[model samples]
Target: MGKTLALVVFAAALLSAQAPAKKTTAETPEARAARIHKQAIVVDTHIDTTMMLGRDGWDFMVRHQPESGENHVDLPRMREGGLDAAFFSIYMPGTVTGPEAVKRALILIDHVRRLTEQHPNEIALATTAAEVRAANKAGRIAALMGMEGGHMIDDSLAVLREYQRLGVRYLTLSHSVNTNWSDSSGDKPAHNGLTDFGKDVVRELNRLGVMVDISHVSDKTFWDAIETSKAPLVASHSSMRAISGHPRNMTDDMVRALGGKGGVVMINYSVGFLSNERYEAQQKNVPSAELPRVSWEKIVDHIDHAVKLVGPTHVGLGSDFDGTTVPDGMEDVSKLPKITAALLAKGYSEQDVKNILGENILRLLEQVEGVGRQLRAAASKSD
Candidate 1:
């Protein structure tokens, strides 16, 4: 019996020595953050890289850090950030009008397409939710397009339809100024909301499967859009006005209304949108370098507020990269994992994080496309 016990003891010690250390339940926030960021389908619904491509001759193929150059997004940074998908904005300033605007819009669209074409192995143009998933599965970034203003369509549904045909998926009804059909938050209220034509624009967008983005629209216009859209709405890049009190940010009521309709509000990383103090400082001509850097915590605060008001299903990231000045820690796209880490640190569940990262937008896209397919089928049958 003593010899048998000795043999068992010897065997137990040998096994203990051979066994790998058991992973602890407590994972370092950084390690956990990296895992979540990598596993999630991180999609930014609004990026102005298309404009950068058109103006700066920025090379999308090479990674450009913010410190090294003016570029905020590029292929390498996206990969480093674990950004699975992004919608490059075909943004025309509100001041540009007439055929020149349309020409510029077309040029930006062509630029985005050319970038994807040139970097076929690195990025793929995704027109549908399935395509986005496929791109992610194949380890390629899904590149999608969104028109930043309805003015680019030039008061014509035909131009809008043509943009849809050319793979423009979402249209922000206005930019910093009011369009003919829709009032902008940054401009004096003209129609008090969407004009008669604006309602029609929403309907046409619903039929075409293009998302109606209300980021820059006036509050009245936001309600008009909520009442008008058949499909779920998307605030392509806006934060909580209740948090920052900025006109560009959505009010609590607006956030709830959007969430009620099964839409998602992609939180913008713009310092102006994320913090009222920073915004006011900037308005007062405080040198950007003199201004206090907006913390990652503030960004998380916006996300938390939105989630509290609308639940996690309605919140997502929209960074607004290459379009606006980003916050301190999140200087560029490559620092995106910091968001996941911050969210995790706040005790957000993995599933909720997944939804917020990309799944919510993907589900909304699929539903919007499904509606479009049904409309097309019905029209064909009538014909």
Candidate 2:
């Protein structure tokens, strides 16, 4: 009895001496990393945040408190999710033509500037990749601008150059409409792709150090831009066609070519881009759960494909929050940690994840800037 009691006492003592494993503190490196990613320079290259800015009943910076709603982005939500940067789209509709379209573009650009001016401490305007980093370091949301449709420039290189001067860093050569020079992927094969002027836009963008976003351009236009630009291009918000055969998606060949060119294909988080079932269900207006997820697994699959094509540096995230309905797993900007965890599970090192999260985009932007600088120098020498 005495020996048994002694053994029991010893066991009790051992248990007491060992402290229970505590939950990881939010302040821990892992927690901080998750938090930083949520808060870090998470950039969504395409968001229709400016769409609501022109409307009377909408406010962009307020945290959306209502649980049931269709809106995907808001300032409070961004704060909660740690969203540090985003490209507010001056997205124009194709219906407006000529001078009217240019006017609308200006209105949208003004609205974006107003939003930034109103939220000076919380947000700041950023034109270059360097500005994005500087703005983030200063603990402010970097509100970069991009013109979604080339038509917004009114078919004038002067207008396009003006938009660039107004802090626009990238221009989507086509936006579901065929421009005088470039054809859109949304339209059936026309113009056989980009015309000479379309190629000029690419050249000018490269010379100006402005990024050429191939999203929404025709496959031919996409390839043409790739061949024409002196700087690495980006498909700002697109997905791999191997997973979902949407015409809007980049084909395996395109993905491979983009990787080969050292360009980054930032994964689009739209459900339609993630899975075939989801794309079909979305087309059929089916509810979400019934639709397949571009699960963290599927996202990894795209990243894996990118790795096979481009060797990892060419893949990045471009969650189209506020622009379109994203996948369920990526419902909001806040759920980015799940992506990090999923990436880790897929054997992506911390460095690789970091690159995917934002580094690649930064590097590509810098390349564009470098090209712009060289062009300016050459122009000056010629003068």
Candidate 3:
């Protein structure tokens, strides 16, 4: 009887081992990522879709594919990517300056404003952080404008004021070439950083409630902007130099200093900015099509490095979409969900992820606006 009982027990154990395992009831990484991403107010601080406007007559209403030429962010892809807001850049090449720069900037702003009005159901023009939240709440993507070069302002405070009135929220001090007042990373150091007039520009922007974007500026200019600006500055579309070793990318010390002062560095999605090897290929005059692709995971790596250096509050997204080549797998705005998913896998908490996505920049905007209010009030009193 004992041997028979033992045989029966052994048979049951064998059956239990052979049976399929029960599925877990816990939430999956993908599902959790989606949930958190959907719940977050996603904002991309830089995109060059406006540049595509003059060239190919880019329409915000149309859904553009990844394979399309320099057409990255659009309304449909933004919705698919859960992007609640984006800053459409008013771009002008370094060669295009003076009246032409001013004219082009005005035209681009007009285009974005008109497009937003034309697609009222899908988009809303936003200037303030409050307006951005309101637009997202109403289930519409917020269309924000940023000037890509200080030269576009025509060296006039009145023009800058008009730009602010027309909803230009940030002004990148320089582009690939140095402006009269500010030095650019891509050019020979002309002003040695920022001229006296450049510092004045920073001050005026603070008074006008426009963010001072230090993306393409030289290291000296970056430091000067940080020092002169009353409000916290933004590196609208820059990555980390420690990771990619590009001069266009910020150093770890720059990141730390920027974060220490309440400023944020929005990571650019350019593969060359995220990977040194790819950047080397770019320097060798390799064509964009032939430029070796970097893993999209490098995007998250940049975010991770920034977060680790300055905590999540100082890091945000500023995909240089339509302006530069991105890493593989992040073909267009549609693939942004992968970033949130990867962050989750890297053990970022939901709130941290949300902060990095948009909240941090929103907070920065609100603070900048508050400072503007104070400055204006003081000016009124002085008068």
Model 1 TM-score relative to the real fold: 0.92
The prediction achieving the highest TM-score against the true structure is 1
Instruction: Report lDDT per candidate.
Output: 0.91, 0.80, 0.91
Return the TM-score for each candidate structure: 0.92, 0.87, 0.92
Give, for candidate 1, the lowest lDDT window spanning 10 residues: 54-63
Rank ordering of all candidates by lDDT, starting from the highest: 3, 1, 2
Write the candidate numbers in order of decreasing TM-score.
1, 3, 2
lDDT of 1 by residue, 292-371 (tens): 67886788899999999999999998989989888877888898888888788789998899899999999889988988
* TM-score, cand. 2 vs. native: 0.87
Error at 281, model 2, angstroms: 4.5
The alpha-carbon lDDT assigned to residue 139 of candidate 2 equals 86
C-alpha RMSD of each candidate structure in angstroms: 3.4, 7.0, 7.0
Across 1-383, the per-residue lDDT of candidate 2 in tens digits comes to: 99999999999999988969778755654664674465435676777778878888788876664336547678877777666788888887765769999888889999988888998998899988889999888888889888888888777899989998888888998988788788998887677778998899888888878889999889999988888887888898888888788788999899888878778888877767778877877789887667665664676677777777777688887776677766556667666676766676677776777778777888888887988999989999999
lDDT of 1 at 298: 84
